[model samples]
Target: MTRNTDDDGIVVLGHPRSGTTLLRRLINLHPNISSPPETHLLSACARFLDADMTADGVDMGVLAGLDFSGFSESDVLKELRQFSFGFLQRIAERKGKARWAEKTAFDIFHLKNIEKLCEDHVYYVAIVRHPLDVAVSCTEFCTSMGTYPSTLHEYIKRYPQPIEAFAMSWLETTKALMDLGRKRSSRFIMVRYEDIIEDENEIMNSVFQFVDEEHGCDQAQSIFNSIPEIGFSDHKSLQEKSIHKKSIDRWRSLPSPQVKRLGELLNPLLAELGYDEIENTGEIGTTAARRRYATSLALHAAKTNETDDDTKD
Candidate 1:
């Protein structure tokens, strides 16, 4: 079995269906590289911030006051990250590889913390996809999974928000990283999701070359060549027709009205991202402004969650 180095690891971050999984599968095939299953460290940290923070229903602010740092620096979190890395490293080494990669979309929300945990720079490979498509898939999942919100209006009438929340956050999170990378472009390497599906070889080779030169790793072709032609569940064949591309975009089939609303909500971010509507869909400037106003209303609703303990009372 090969024990891989913590150095030269890479992280793929973005909204789901943005090709992070595909990219990780491709990169982990490199001989000098290793990558683990989606460890979701960044997602865990995001949960600490944006979602439920504890079994006791305490806010993250309260937890911080009790000194999460004391817990953070303790053996628990360190061991968690290390075990996650080391476990994957062992798997890669047994496969005769030298480096490892991890792909988790929600990790971008806690990029700073992930960087600190690694303490060694890991290049971020950000992934992005069409919000309309993502929203449709997410919405359908709610129906299929029997997790639909109780009310038609997810905001005031029901719970768990909507599939649009994921779509909205996906745009905001990508924008935040793009904003950071725009300032520190040297530290960031970006690859578009379309580049993978549309220009696979070119994008893959360029990524391999960049990681090699950037990390000064030895030749990595052995691992690169081992990537299954068309990945599926472990026991499955990699044939094109047999392969399940169930994950591909299907939002085009949505009702025109709903699709239009989705486009309106995501238009600014999409346009700013150089994404055009497939059939010249999506709203323009005014629609994006409306999204902001809607977001402000949601923000006020969230503010009501605060307690007296959270206040300076």
Candidate 2:
């Protein structure tokens, strides 16, 4: 099938809990853009292409079968690329929109495959938040809500502390996305979650301009009126009717010891991303902040059966 590269698509990339959903909602507010829920389509395709054997050690056999049937690997891949775009394009058409954008948490890891699939036809929007804030939020979700249990388990096995695991995740994912942004500056842009909350008009205008779409900042306040019913997105974002700075610097409320540990691991990346260095003075936070921190620690301890000693100053 002949592809129309002029009909541009967008892919939003960021670590989980990095405000990609909020960005997706804002982008969807544009009359011409249809930002859909997490699909992870490219990752699935990449896995299929890269997998040589199944869990039981049996060969995957699909490619070998296709080879026997006179189909080359390139042929199958070309069709897969076309299928991905067509799937998204049809959804955009159904919504009466001219363009489509997809947001999935793990998509940042599969950008090379996505770039091969869409070439110049897709634009990337990488949203980032403070690593400390991301780690705090992610730990809360993992321990309290039981979200991403396997991911948390894997990280726990690798790192000595949950906050360290989450901080490393943010560092790796953000570095990968930032590297791609530098390589493809024309087709890529990075948006800070704090900037969006602080200056919605300017940040969003630049985002739209990057995607070659008309600016819709006038309707940004109402963007949440029609939140997508995607199950895997940040549920908290769906509840919010507008952007706020409530989550900004949430890491400040965490205990000093944990903050200092996170600072030791993430301070370099924080500087690279233009964020302030983490200050871990052993000072007491507000009542509410301390209460929240204590709750998160309790939840983490309960979930992992680990002692909360490390969190103490």
Candidate 3:
């Protein structure tokens, strides 16, 4: 398939509450970039292409019908690619922008399939936040909204605790994108949410350059000048249009027990992602109980190390 430079788009990948919406809004401030709200368009197309006859106890024989009509897999994929590009291109054209970007946090899980649908025509920008903060934000969002979204709702059912569910979600999504970045180094870039809050101008300049767009510090600043209510996004961003560091360490407010559990769940990835480890002490329990817990953790670590040494030997 011939690629049109004008139709090249970007996919913003991240877990929920990981600053993907903020990144998308900033990217939209560029005159040449048109990033709409969460559409889940690429994932939708991927599902359609992979649909089978017995999905969800329903007869989704669309692919079979296409095959019966003499369309090859490549033929259907080509048509879907054209349709996807044309749909987004028309959006960009209407907005008087040369490029379009899509942000659906759940799309991180389906990236391998989405990449096949869009092939090499899309650039990926993955924005990640500390998992503990992400878990805290997810809990707060669910509490305030009075309902859990499908993804979080499902995760909540699987894990004994809500924070663990969110931490696992963050780990899986961030790990998937990070692995992809290694494979597609030239086409993928990761933006840490903390960096954006700490240095907006420099971080956004690198982001714009990643997508082959000019950096306009003035336009980027315009994000705080106005807030557009986007659907399926962090509404807190709409409420507080300005970037600040207040939420950077929100997990600290969680009780020590919860914080310790999160540290156990996310410490390695947190360190790998260059965030400081969550301190597991403070307000956890009585002094004696805390010492027992610490000693147990040490014993477990020693046992694991012994196993590793045995395997090496």
For each of the candidates, the C-alpha root-mean-square deviation to the true structure, in angstroms, is 14.8, 8.2, 11.8
What ordering of candidates by TM-score runs from best to worst? 3, 2, 1
**Backbone clash numbers for all candidates listed:** 13, 0, 0
Per-residue lDDT of 27-80 in model 1, one digit per residue for the tens?
Answer: 765557766456665556534434246788765552354355575443544665
lDDT of 1 at 54: 77
TM-score per prediction, in order, is: 0.60, 0.79, 0.81
Q: Among all windows of ten consecutive residues in candidate 3, which has the lowest summed lDDT?
A: 52-61
On residues 33-132, what C-alpha lDDT tens digit does candidate 3 reach at each position? 8888777788788667565456456535555678788987678877888888777778888999888888877787677778767666678888999888
Candidate 1 scores a C-alpha RMSD against the true structure in Å of: 14.8
| CA deviation > 4 Å runs, candidate 1 | 1-6, 41-84, 115-120, 141-163, 213-249, 277-313
For residues 1-313, what per-residue lDDT tens digits would candidate 2 score against the true structure?
Answer: 2335564888888887888888888887888988777777777776666546668885565665687799986788778877887787888889999888988776766666666565556788889999888888888877768666554566778986777888888887788888788877778889899999999889999998877767965677776776456557777777887788899988788668678767877888888889988875665457866797799998987866544444552
Ranking by lDDT: 3, 2, 1
lDDT of 1: 0.58
